[model samples]
Target: MRKWLVRRALAVNVRVKILGIALGVAVFLGGATIVFLRGYLVRVWTEDLRVRAVEIARDNASRSTDFLLTNNLYELYALLRGAVDGNPDVRYAFVLGPDGAVLADTFGPAFPADLLSVSTVRVADDAEIALLQSGHSRLHDVAIPIYDGRVGTLRLAVSEDRMRAQIGEVVAHITLMTGLAAGFGIAAAFLLTYALTQPIAGLLHATEAVGREEFAHRVDVQTTDEFGALGESFNTMIERLGVVERQRTELLKRILTVQEEERSRIAHELHDHTGQELTALLYRVSVVAEAPTLEAARGELIELEKAAARALKEVRLLAFEMRPAALRDLGLAAALQHEARAFTQLYGFAVRCHVAGLGEVALDGESETAVYRIVREALMNTAHHAQANNASVLVQARNHTLVAIVEDDGVGYDADAVLAGPPETRFGLLGMTERARLIGASITFESSPGAGTTVYVEIPIGAGAAEGADDADSSPDSG
Candidate 1:
């Protein structure tokens, strides 16, 4: 049942929920106030009615003492009639003799016999009051002694109808005021809900726009509160998302361009180098088959074998350049040494390779490939862009991390300007960054217009082989 109620509440709009809370509070407060005031007014008014009845009875008794003492029956009757006529709340006033006989009563000829027995003044010092029922009305019966009960007792009844009527009027006024207050409270609540939900509605619309890939949508910030902060944060996020989207698009384009360039390079190498070598070997084979003598055929066969070996070597070299077998068989350290030597020969730069405690750190295949590719791309960038004479590659295991550094003594370009430059120029750097990210590694470049560039890649290693690993940079000569 509790879950059902919560779900129902959540299913409604925020405005409805706020209005419900406001209404409930108003109803509860108004109802409680009315009940409390009603009870208070009934108690106070009932007490006041009793006090008034007692006062009138005592005064009538005191005034009638002389008439009773003088045996003036007509004057006593006139006093009782006057008391009844003077006060509208007073229903009747009567006098009883000391022996409990009716002496005078405002009831005239129809004086009730039961009323004579209804009240008696046991203590003569003060008035005694009793509550009585008279048909549809309730009355306070005040009994007081006349002349210390030697003359008679005065009984005066005050009806509660007038007090009840006044209480009704006051309660009606309170209820009407409560209703007006509740109406005003609801109006205020409506305005409050609108103020609160307006920002939320804006956020919802902005989120929908984001879902549609509309990153230009921005929320209006009008206040310095949390809602305003949220709007600002959302706008900032959308701006960042727009930047990331553009970067992703640029990366995809770069990937396609790189693929096409690699394919073209491979096709050119196969055609220009391997194709010529194979064609020469085929010619030598035909020559050996058509030789006239054994000695001539033997020389032709030897030439054919040499040509075939050259063609085979060219094909193998091309295959190795594409994906080196040493990388898979000898691990990342040995593969990097081979790459450094090849780079030195190709770029005409002295490249030094260093490794420290690399064998102790276990790397997954993907991580090894990512690190190797990132280092290779950094070397290629140095060769093409940096006018460097010497370079070095460092692979070290330190503090449960594998760190690789590639540095060159060459004229380096501005790192920030190159990165923020055209996509064509920054594609290599972006590729290196992406490769490092895939391996959960971080890559940084330090470069200036005159200073040499250094690329740093740090990959976290597991604790399995981290113990006893070297925590220092390897010497330039070490591998």
Candidate 2:
């Protein structure tokens, strides 16, 4: 049912409305005119028939009065018969005597018996006209007394067939006119509605194109109206979206390239550092196995132990680079402090770590890890490229948010240039941004050519904030 209704709604449009309204108006006006004209014509025709009947009856009665007074039944009957037979419009003409009996009739000796029983109406001067129905047809009867002192009535009936036929022809003509009006109305509606909806149709097409990812598709501005302005605005929006989409595409490519480079660096570090140490350890083992005396074996043993230790250290460093256990075992702050110390030792720089609210605010494990990685990456970027003497890492909860800021007083590159430039230079930044996004956080970089760089990350401590704080309070680190 819902689908059916949706289809019905979709089917409705400007063209249908215009045509329907045009046809509906035409029909309403035409029907009303037909009804009015039919009633008016019928009344006028009926009146004309009644007048004709009365006039014929009055004239015939005037001429036959003397005959009636002289008891001239032959002339009187002939006069009545002449009125009925001579006028096609007259169906019946009759004379009623003082006894209310039919004295003469055009129906001849076979005249209807019901005529004698017809109700009598007394009149003063003008003829009395009464409408009567006989079978399927209606008639107008005009009855007049022969004279003022006469005790007889002269009656004539005029069939309304001619009047009805005229009305029918007029009705036919009206129907034809109404049909013509509807056709013209529909045509005008088609033109008008099409003109109005053409712009909207273009906009719809543009929207569909946009949905299909055709961001270059634009609607034509046909006029200096609202629709034109809307079209212009829509085109502008699409153009901007196209730019953003291109930027995102480039950003994604850069992120992938950076990932490959990082993987290569890790492989290089493991192969060069750990492999050399293991090779040295194996050579030392062989030397120990081939020693001629205890003293010789003892020296090889010492070197073997040293090689093993160096190999183990390199392996540990690789493991730590992959994921530091401190992030999970101790907490985010401890992890940051450890990373800061490592960065300082590796880069020969002074690193400061300040963590407030980590012990006070309870954060979920994912949140802790995300914050830790974001800060670690920011510091690494600083150490690798900032060329700064010192850097600072701050992790705290403020204003209902967990905020981490990594800043270095160094010669910073343009943030916009790096972002809009090649992906290789900003892949790490994109990765950091993506990680922040994954944990429902926002990350931003504040930097200029010479103003240094500040990487800020904020994560909302929403539903899990209270639980995290409780967990922190119960832990040994929450002092």
Candidate 3:
């Protein structure tokens, strides 16, 4: 039942939830206040009523002392009647003889015999009070001795109806005030809900805009609080996403451009070098076929064989440049060494290659290719741009991970500035980053002006490789 209630409450919108909370608080506090005030007022008013009754009875007894002592029955009856008529709370007043006989009473001739037995006060006593129930009304019967009760006693009864009526009026007034307070509380709750939900609504709309690929959408920050900070964070995320999208588009264009350039270079090599060699071999073959003597034909056949060998070598070199055979035959370690040696010969810079613990690490085919291409790109950048004289490539396996580093002792340029530069200048670095991403690896570059550049690559190589790679890719330095 508790779980159901929680779920039901959570299912409501923020505005409804806030309003419900406010209403509950107002009703609880208002009801409590009303009950407390009602009880307090009743106690205070009841005490006041008792005190008023006693005072009225004492005053009547004191005034009637002379009337009773002189045996003036007319004056005494007139005095009792005047007391009853003058005060609305006094129900009736009467004087009794010392022998318990009724001397005078406001009831006149209809005075009941039971009235004498209702209350009594001794001659030495000051006053005595007793409660009497007369039909539906309750009365306080106060008895006081007149002249020390040597003459007679005065009996006065005060009704509680008037006090009850006043108490009812007070309770009604308090209830009305409580209702007004509740109304005001509800209005304040509505304003509070509006202020809170407005920012949430803005966030929801901005999220929807992001879903529709509207990268320019922004949230309006209105306060210096957590909500404002959240808006700022969301805007930062959108801006970064926009940057990534633009970089992806430019990277695609650069890839296509690089592919076309490589294809053109290959085509030119085939036509100018291999094509000429093949054509010369073919002409020598015709010469051998049309030779007049066997000696002439043997000589022509030697020249044709030489031309054929040169063409084969040219074709083999072109194929190696496209996809190295060593990579498939001897694995990643041997392939990197072969590329390093080739780079040293072509670029006139000594390139050293080192490998360790690679036999223990198991890398998938795509992962191996990505690492190789990334290292190759790093070396190319160092040779062409870093003005490096000596470079080294290191590949090692450590704790279920494969790490590679390419370092060059050259005049290094600022890595951040280069990455943020024009697309054409940063294609090599961007291409290496893209390759690492495809293989679930992370790559980073450390370089500054006049300092040697270092390229770092890390690839997970065990059962938890995918998860580890995801963590690394999400890191800030992974680019």
TM-score, candidate number 2: 0.72
Q: Mind giving the per-residue lDDT tens digits that candidate 2 earns over 136-254?
A: 78877777887752658788888988678889998999889888877887888888787778888988999999899898898988888887888899999989888767657877777
- Which ranges of candidate 2 are over 4 A from the true structure? 1-137, 144-149, 158-181, 188-212, 220-241, 359-370, 384-387, 398-400, 412-429, 466-479
Better of 2 and 3 by lDDT: 3
Candidate 2: deviation at residue 339, Å?
Answer: 2.9
Model 1: pairs clashing at backbone N, Cα or C within 3 Å = none
What shift in Å separates residue 375 of candidate 2 from its native position after superposition? 3.3
Rank candidates by TM-score, best first: 1, 2, 3
The alpha-carbon lDDT assigned to residue 70 of candidate 2 equals 88
Count of backbone clashes, every candidate in sequence: 0, 2, 0
What would the per-residue lDDT of candidate 3 be over residues 1-479, giving only the tens digit for each residue? 99999999899999998899989988898889878977887778766776777788778888888887788899988988888999998999888899988899988679877867665433224777778889988887888888888998888888988887887788788778878888888888899898788888888998998898888998888977888888888889888887777788899998888799999999999999999998898899889989999999999988998999999999989988777777776677777888788888888788888877676235877888788889899999988988998888888777878899999999998899998898778888889998988888899989998999999999878854323221111111111
- On the 0 to 100 scale, the lDDT of residue 122 in model 2 is 38
Looking at model 3, how many pairs of residues clash? 0
lDDT of 1 by residue, 63-150 (tens): 9999988889899999888888899899998888899888888887887788756654433357777778999899888888888888
lDDT of 3: 0.83
Error of 3 at 199 (Å): 3.2
